[model samples]
Target chain A: MYKIKVHVYLKENILDPQGKAVTNALHQLGFNEVQTVRVGKYFQLFTDNVDDIESRIKSMCQKLLVNEVIEDVDFTIENAA
Target chain B: MYKIKVHVYLKENILDPQGKAVTNALHQLGFNEVQTVRVGKYFQLFTDNVDDIESRIKSMCQKLLVNEVIEDVDFTIENAA
Candidate 1:
């Protein structure tokens, strides 16, 4: 099996209320060092092969993974035994 | 203020139990077409300026925004009036 990673975030000019909330919570918990905070998405995927990983996953991203106008994503691949 | 976006996801080959769970939930909700599913983080940030957006936000990602070892992420930027 293979593994795929996906991340999603909003554009720089966009505002993130959720991120701010989390940052506040984390700070309250004692991690006050988090001066600036933004929240995003994280995922790990398992697949059969890499032959079609990009085309398939990228398509999935556009359709179901991302909000193109206001978000960005970076993906990684690996062989999982 | 300027806005910043951040995303974080697990690297390919990594296993995401949470993603699987969400996929299952979505499937149960009726989106069965989702053959493969992974979940990640998404964030939007507001900043005072862009001059230091990259250095500051990128550093935030490494220190707090991302897991580095098992996740991938992409972010966008825009000017907010």
Candidate 2:
């Protein structure tokens, strides 16, 4: 099987209110060194070996896993036992 | 500055309905090779250099970034321009 780890996050220009809130909370908690926080989604997928796994995974991301207009996605695929 | 990437996921034995839903959706989309899908949270934090950054980051995870009861967190810290 192949193990795919995907990370989807907001575009750099996009506002991330959740991340901002977390930053503020961290500051209030005495972690003043924290400058910024960006939140995103992570996914782990286990799939049977297939032809052109990279393209297939990318298609999956485009079709169902990510909103391309606002989010950017990157993934790493590795062999799994 | 230091860049920290944090990943938080539910405990192995915990039920992940959201992941299950995504798996079903993928199957519906004809991606039958997909065997399992696990979803988690990802966070990127930018922080000023500090003493014992590793320990401090761990503290942050324990105190605010993770529930620790049902979720597990792991992070990587690196220097950033």
Candidate 3:
């Protein structure tokens, strides 16, 4: 099997309310160090197919894993078993 | 400023319904290669404090950013203007 790690995040132009909320909370806690925060999704996929795995995962991302119009995804695959 | 990237995921023994659902959907879509899927959260924290940033972020993760009982968090810090 292969272990795939994927990171998905909003495009640079999009507004992320959850991130803003977290940032504000940090500031309220007197953590003046915080400048900004952005929240997103991470996914791990276990697969049996090993051949051309990167392309396969990319295809999966395109079809169901991400909204290409608003989010960008990056992934890495590792051999598990 | 510094950019802190965090990855938060469920503990090994925890059940991930969202991951399972995605796996089932992929199989139904004829992608039998997929064996399992796990979903998690990712965060990017922009901070102004660069000195001893790692410990500070780890403290944040332990306090409000994660449920220590159910999830594990890992983070990296980068220098960003």
Q: Compute the TM-score of each model's chain A versus the native chain A and list the values.
A: 0.85, 0.93, 0.88
Residue A75 local lDDT, model 3: 86
RMSD of 2: 1.1
> Per-prediction DockQ, in order?
0.26, 0.87, 0.80
- Scanning candidate 3 chain B in windows of ten residues, the lowest lDDT window is B47-56
Which ranges in model 3 have alpha carbons more than 4 Å from their true place? none
What is candidate 2's lDDT per residue for A1-81, written digit by digit as tens?
888999999999999999999999999989888899999999999987767888988999999999999999999988887
Model 3: per-residue Cα lDDT over B1-81, one tens digit each: 778889999987999999999999888877788888999999999877777777888888887789999999888888777
TM-score of 3: 0.93
Sort by lDDT, top down from the best: 2, 3, 1
lDDT of 3 by residue, A6-49 (tens): 99999989999999999888878767788889999999888777
For model 2, report the TM-score of its A chain: 0.93
Give one digit per residue, the lDDT tens place, for model 1 in A6-70: 76767768988886777886566544444556677766666665665677667767766688999
Q: Report, for every candidate in turn, its global Cα lDDT versus the true structure.
A: 0.67, 0.92, 0.87
Write out the backbone clash pairs for model 2.
none
Instruction: Mark the regions of model 1 whose C-alpha exceeds 4 Å error after superposition.
Output: B1-81
RMSD of each: 7.3, 1.1, 1.4
